[model samples]
Target chain A: DPVTGVFRGVIAGCGYFSRHHLEAWRRIEGVEITATCDSDPARARAAGLAAYTSADQMLEKERPHFLDLVTRPETHLELIRTAASRGVAVICQKPLAPVWGEAVEILRIARSAGIRLMAHENWRWQPWYREAARLIRQGAIGQPHAYCLRMRHHEGRGDDPFPAQPYFRDMPRFLVYEILIHHLDTARFLFGEIETVCAELARLNPAMRGEDRAVITVRHQSGLTGVIDGHTLHPSASGVALGDAWFEGGNGRLALDPNGNLWTERGCVWRNDVAAGYRGDSVRAAQAHFIECLRSGAPFETDIEEYLRSMAAMEACYLSAERKAIVSPLKFLVDSQSE
Target chain B: DPVTGVFRGVIAGCGYFSRHHLEAWRRIEGVEITATCDSDPARARAAGLAAYTSADQMLEKERPHFLDLVTRPETHLELIRTAASRGVAVICQKPLAPVWGEAVEILRIARSAGIRLMAHENWRWQPWYREAARLIRQGAIGQPHAYCLRMRHHEGRGDDPFPAQPYFRDMPRFLVYEILIHHLDTARFLFGEIETVCAELARLNPAMRGEDRAVITVRHQSGLTGVIDGHTLHPSASGVALGDAWFEGGNGRLALDPNGNLWTERGCVWRNDVAAGYRGDSVRAAQAHFIECLRSGAPFETDIEEYLRSMAAMEACYLSAERKAIVSPLKFLVDSQSE
Candidate 1:
């Protein structure tokens, strides 16, 4: 495939999100998904590729140029290790691992093997945030100082709310880990690095195990601060952008309505037209970036080493809620170095 | 005069906010502002009352039944002390005192002298909140669990903003003390007693000595939580309500728009009709309650003892921001008892 100028790719875990990855790889110019693997043969067959129930068997036989790991957080490490030993590059999904120690191990494995790795953090690639970043750089909001995203999703209510993802009910750490982590990553992508985090979490829905509501405040190293007021049990007008957002600056403020329209004091700056794809076709965009970087030998925007900082910030949110104090994510990173 | 049902009153510190108090007092029946006093003779004379440079002189000459203290936070303790010694019940403007110790001393003087004291804390008396309380009690938004107020004010920008209150630029503590304290009081009035407070404070404008922005999170004793996200240097649609608010509950959510209209998921629940006076003429409503309670010998709703909790919560916000940890307002109250 390399001699023929084609980049062959294969995906592990043909679960709910794997469809997006498959479709994206199909659309990219020079990339081809050689096969799909899942523990469940039915799910693997659903991908309509060279189906296999064993990822190791598929990797050894197909020997694809890249592996896309879309499995749950716990499965990520072993899958990455399998790919790394075979000298196959990886694009892994986020939270890298559920806990900090596992995440550090995953990173160490990737670094030691020298395999190209990227975390599939696609929220920042969502057209609205991308447009907001453009306008911010264009002086649309003039020296931005703060950002706020009020996220409301009604799917976490009732006894069996998350029917699509039943595993959501049993998770000890729910909203911040599974959901708001994307916004945290988007915050980092838009505003510089985060320095400190403080959060107040509550479980509004008693049927669920973890906190459903949270007010997370983060201060960037640039002294620009932000708050993510999120609740999964509340009624929201639109789920397209998750919720509405406002980015405040000295001269003006930018607002992202639920319809994915970005507005400044002047008027509507950008409008989101296509609603068919996944979150403004962000998965496709993110996949395209991964493939392009592999071909060009350029680094991924969300390279594994750098993404550990986002993981640390997410860890700090839980720590802040537990200790009822502000926590520095840098401590987690510094401690991880020793490990 | 007691038999004839006339209540004579004197007002001290005839400055900017004093006008609202004076207007409200004039509108209330069976009460007369017999005189006004201020250190600046021009401001004192502007009230169109018999004016004096010394508050003690006005209190002696007028022999009013009550004193309305509309002075700054630093002046509150001395004014309350002066009024209490002369057996003049006082209605003092808030922050109650700039610090907890002086607030305790002010309460001690009022209690020992047996003079009735009420804090003129009136944001909760705003018609929109009154309607919200009614709706919440009516089970419109079922079992409210959280509340959020995103407050934006454009008056704190540029080199010389806040022209009406130039002293605003020099205060060691600006927004939280002078402004957001009202929202905190209203939070308690709407939700319940606050148990813990967490806040992140920032000064967006270099001209101000204190913080111009804050994200304050409070957990109530009743398990309800609220976030007040406020910044003074950003553009907002309306200054009438100061910002917009959302109250989330089990069944639905309640929204308060900038025009003071309250909305539920079904439709507009409450529409604010009158725009005259200060914040829905809440000052007038608050003054009316004070006079009615005085004549009927009923207790003031914001009696010094109860109002202290709101002040303590305000103090806890400052402490939380300073220590970078959650602080309990009860600790401040308990410590004040020993003081």
Candidate 2:
């Protein structure tokens, strides 16, 4: 018997992103990822744990402390029900539901079951942004007036989706939901909850089902404006800068360069030492946070209800583009109750 | 009687910015500053030339080949009319009038008199943007889908406009019409004429008469969207980067840093050598373009009719903010005649 309440776990889904989940779980102290399951037999075996093609079988046999869910959105509701039926905790990856309402429903079910559910929103866990937010609260930049994050990359030009994430070819709610939700969440995490989301989306690449180019603007409760942008078609031979940002405040400015250096107006260049940690350090940090919250009775930073703001923001972005008008995410959430 | 047809000229308004005009004019080989005029005696005399407090006295007495009116908008129509009545060629500064209609009226007077007119919109002449535009046309970036320029400064925090020009404190349309108009023209210079201009403005600074922050988005005829931003409250300790831009095309990216360097996705860092010429190289560039157009009977790039596009775009930005809706410049121009 594991008398320490060692928190044995099983992580489902072995896609390319699943490797980070497995690696992160191994690094957390007092946690053992006792088994791994994937529909693909080879992927399941490759995780170097007790492999199973059946998630139900793994849950029945392992009876772990948590079920780490890293699967696609379509499989999320069924998996969540499966886990909740057994009364286990869950730390799931995002696009928790391709449909925003479905995500809300999933959260409602999990909360009713009294399970500790943490969505894998790791952008806020990234060191540079965390430090930027810390300094902003410390008046390093004063009251932020404008914020921008550019997440342009070159991995989306093919006629079909790239090999790594082959399913992306048909992600109808692509950039804003799949990739840009992280930025939207980060903005909310750094700034306060947004008041309105106004976005203009463009589908520049023929290969993708949804828009690949986005210019999303948000107004925060603090009367500041922000932009989260992606230009996948924007060519870059060498500057593989992702999530580069410039946050403007009343007294000073803090900008994050692609290379993890934060430039401030006070002539300080704080190299993001946190980002310099081992390859999966943010994942490790996130996992640690989840475990700590689970053990100590502290709430998860990206708990079911808390992470919904990000999820609502993502939906607002799509609706903003769809309607060609600014959509107030909070208002949308409130209005959806009547619907 | 310098026989090089040394286009003798009188420059009006020897205010703070007039020095750049005078310095640039002096650097141009065939132009001679016959006189300098300012409403303030001290300002006029400060310009190392035959000085007069009244522009009328200078134009009547000097009878130079051209007149440069660099004074405030309130005096532009009278000055341009004064010069045009004599059929002398003239170059005037921007905000041709506080009202867009008045600007159009002034241009009509100049055109009817056949006076060669150029607005001293110097930003496009800046070496870095000039080169960036050149490269974009040369297929450096495959086909621009997005562009952004950040024009932020600490000049707008106080009730009294800073030392150089105190009148900015009283200007009713500050950022968009005064500062961002250059960006509007530059966007047209780099991309095609804008089809729609959308802007959201805020009066973040309590002391200013007009908006201190603006987020203006434009859709170019080429199916690209661009943003021009100003956040006065955003703090920056030392990066006095002005007109910093990131232009994204299908194949590559072009960025201009405040330090006069253009970064290309091709891994080339082309130092903008033109910026090294003199304090007023861009002014000189604008003046040179004016003279070349005057001498060659070539129309000005910012000629009255062509320049109306910039003026119209500026009007659209203001109306967009006022209406909280996208305003088409050309459509607004057509609609304004009815108003």
Candidate 3:
């Protein structure tokens, strides 16, 4: 197997974002995407692989070495269970699960199964953030004290807001749960552990059940303070690619424009150059990391534990908004552990 | 006095900001600055007017029609009472008093004396905000649903953070009380009364007694949600001058750059060419309004009642930060009224 080790991979869920994952898996060398499964047969057929209605059917039929669960948060638990039962390594899409208990259960299943599991949180892998982290590490911005990410998309306007994902309007816990979770994980990746989160959420669009706008103040364990200001109701100042971000420190500020350029006001010279693929080929990078870790028997960068931390942070943000107080992400983790 | 209507005004407390007030008063027609007072005789003398060590001495000897109390918040009550006793109209600087009870007492004193009083809340008079308000009124950005102002100055870093105002290090309450109070009043001036406020405060600078950074989420009575994210420690995304802001509505967004240019992306075109003087010569405009009101028997725009509301908002912001909950500024007003 080692002499001719070409691992077979199968994708579960062929939704809007899954296409990126599919493309990425195909690009990663020595990885063959055996088949794709989606609840919607049409979407499964759209993947252009051996199609299956159920992940169990695909896992049994293909016996793929790995399962790429690109499904929604709700379906992740069952799909991960199926993958684990089939003794297949799995890379699941975030938030891992919809709630804290389910996320813990997912972690538990992965641990018991002893299968290689990775949470596909690709925002941090976005070349700009990686470059930002490198800059910070290089002492470009001396002792980074603050960071802010403002993500505003024009899609949450007009009659048909969120055209790609219409279900975004219907989710009770949108914004923070659906999107800012990526930012929260990315924040952790860039700024280290989060100590506390105080958030204010608003539902600007009448048709949406959940909050369309959110401003979350994050206090890192390292004493760094930052804000994640995001909304779907309006376009961002930088014209809404992934919005804009800035990392401020002792020297100066490192800014990420909408077009994915990471340049500083002065001194620090770093550029992302707007690479090809999705968000600087972050999906490809994320998938490649999973495959490399599996081949080398190395731990995942976003393992179940790290993903749980990000998930807890998201939970804390929602709780802070509801309670009108600062919430510690650690409390959720500790609570879940006790339970 | 009605024939010429040349009102003689004297300045009390010749501090750092008081210079702008003095300059503004000098520029105003039909208003002559007869004298200036400060406990520090040197500061009073620097005004190049008839100087005195005490406001009482200045008020009695100058017999001015109005007193511009440019002193600090703690000194406001005594100076205002002195002006009231002399039956002199007073235009006091913001935070009418440091505490709620003192501010209410100042209001009561003004009411009982039946003297003309105004709060020098000059930020709303800033040419950009004025243009922004006009644009909103003209439906440039449609019904405004959200606003965010981020003010970051480079002064709150290193050993001596606030060089201009060295006393900033000593203030028990900073940021929101000293600076963002202007933005809160400006928000009221632009988008009606604030229904609730939730804030997260941090002290990034080690030497400062108070929080140097804050992110205050404001929910206006008109359902407009906004944030005032400010810090003294870092330079803003735009340059240091007033940071940047955006008012988002049904149509698009109205953006205000650091250089005082207010413009929309596609349709609307409203601009504020940076004018001379302090923050669009707002101090001059505020003084002009006060002087015009004095001459025409008209009410002051930032009269005692309106000033009290801004004070209440300031109080609520502090309380919200302390209690870790959303607070209504109206409660402070009600509590004061009952007393």
Candidate 4:
């Protein structure tokens, strides 16, 4: 560690969610978040780390072992390229890219340069989801055949979510890209890679330019049919409740109510009172996983190569909605990869 | 009402559900259920009407002006033809035939014989659904853009819904044909006729011969996307709660809980306590509507010709699921009708 007692990391994009990432990195025993960078100096300063307005400046000065990208997807490619060239392992946020082709190319470039890359797919690491997956693997639900997550965060109701994240009101790719991607990636973690995607999207909120609601049906390779049903304009019982979800198998069903409780068809309920603390649960777990992988040379759970499957599913959802059809996501992704 | 003070009707197939039909028929004014016929003499006798072992013998002896066919889909075509040829207006149970081709031919035969025909697609006529449709038309939820009915009757469990209706366990096409067709019809009733269908089916109930669970996505002519998600193996809060449903438009959302409670996005709850009555409130309304049309020469709500819209959607669901593609039900039905 160059006589340094701890592993080093730099985080870019001091947005609304970066606090969780920085806090998470800080919580990890072996790591220190050396610097936090954002385009806006105020946001950088707000993070309370050694702040830099330019990510390149932070990377040059801190020379961190890893770069944590909590920025918008538009900036991820440049950050990944900028960091990977300096032999920095990279962890970018969900979606990975604005589109699948670009994500594929970005990963290809990173891999060719021998850089360890991972997507910050945190939903799979969410405390409740982690417990749910554990039970699922233990056959609590007996071979999961169907999974559904109904998303109705109601953030787009008026100016609520828009106030915290103003760019959401104008993004061309909103619901599925900015939000539902987490659920889709979680579906992959719980169910496996998706095969086909049949989707229908609606712009429920007139103020937003892109779709705020969508119903995406995904058929997993394991014969598991998963649906990511969403309505950003509708509120749940509580504001924190993202959605109600269930994974059904032959013998029983595993359900997650909007209130963050995991329940089973057989009448067992689990609550995750142990919040992830400053890092947030999944963000903490995801960053911890990346750090461990960096140190021990262990394979990442959401390595860019594997994370591309969820991205491919996301890409297919858009295509399916556009074409009004069920398109095979895995087949399309695999074919594109071959090309 | 030929000054006789009675509207005579003969009902065929005295299965378990027929008792509800007979009870509701008794409640209707000016109606005399002259005969109840079944292939089995005991079943006919159990119906407690002027019993007959054969429908043809009952028709010849009683000379009823209308026939209600409550038999299985396999027998639907023959019974429809038998009654229609005698110039009797007919009310037949749904899944008019075993397949789309046969259903098409049966309707064609009825039309050729100049006899009126209607499918007993009663879900649309349910009290809550009717109210929902009325409110939707009145713009309670604004533009009526999306619809979803998640079916979780759990009736297909081991031997629960089997002992009474053994045929369901044996039917080659169960859920979508016998059940989801009702919701698809309801979608049309609430929104408009469907233009395209994208679907996926699963046979969760190993005991059942056909798929007991399905997700049928229908795009209506009005640009409304409706999902009839069926799963006969999953239980809801109660056994009687058919499915949870919602119809979303630009302004708000209209939802029906797994129980009978119907509500709006504005938080107004509605419960249809009057219930559909013995024959199923919808079945009663459907029959009453049929009788009114017979008396006043008005067109039937689910008249075979127009009702084919829903049947087409159901047919397309099978095709879409089988082919893993979206299909035009209207185009398919119209082309089949022309053929």
- Scored by TM-score, the top model is 1
lDDT of 4 by residue, B1-339 (tens): 599767899899888777777877888887888889988899888866799988788888989989988877788887788887788889888777777788788878988999989887778877778878788888887766566887776557775565667788877777887888888888878777777888888777678898877877777776666677777666433433476788776577888876566787567567757654741376678888988888888899999987787888888888888887788887667688578
Candidate 2, residues A45-104, lDDT tens digits: the string is 997889999899999999988999998889998899889889999999998887877887
Which of the numbered candidates is closest to the native, going by highest DockQ? 1
Clashes of each: 0, 7, 0, 1
- The CAPRI category of model 1 is medium
What fraction of the real A-B contacts shows up in model 1? 0.52
- Report residue A4 deviation for candidate 4 (angstroms): 4.6
Candidate 1 chain A lowest-lDDT run of ten: A231-240
Q: Please write out the lDDT profile of model 1 over residues A117-138, one tens digit for every residue.
A: 9999888899999999998988
All candidates: DockQ: 0.65, 0.39, 0.46, 0.38
In order of appearance, the predictions have TM-scores of 0.97, 0.89, 0.94, 0.91
The CA lDDT at B195 in model 3 is 88
Give the candidate order by descending lDDT.
1, 3, 2, 4
List the pairs of residues colliding in candidate 2.
A249-B233, A249-B234, A252-B235, A253-B235, A253-B236, A265-B236, A265-B237
Chain B TM-score for each model? 0.98, 0.93, 0.96, 0.94
Where in model 2 is the C-alpha error above 4 Å? A1-3, A41-62, A158-161, A234-241, A250-252, A263-280, B1-8, B32-65, B81-86, B111-114, B157-161, B233-243, B265-269, B272-280, B336-339
Worst 10-residue lDDT window for candidate 2 chain B reads B234-243
TM-score of chain A of each: 0.97, 0.94, 0.96, 0.94
For all the models shown, what interface RMSD does each have?
1.5, 2.1, 2.2, 2.8
Q: Per-residue lDDT tens digits of candidate 3, residues A1-339?
A: 366789899999889989888888778899999899988999999967899998999999999889988888899898888888878999988768888899899888988998878999888888878888888898887877667888877778767778999998899999999889989998999889999888778888887889888888888898788888888866433442478888877777788887777778764365566556687899899999998898998888899877899999999988987886778899999998888
The predicted structure with the larger lDDT, 1 or 4, is 1
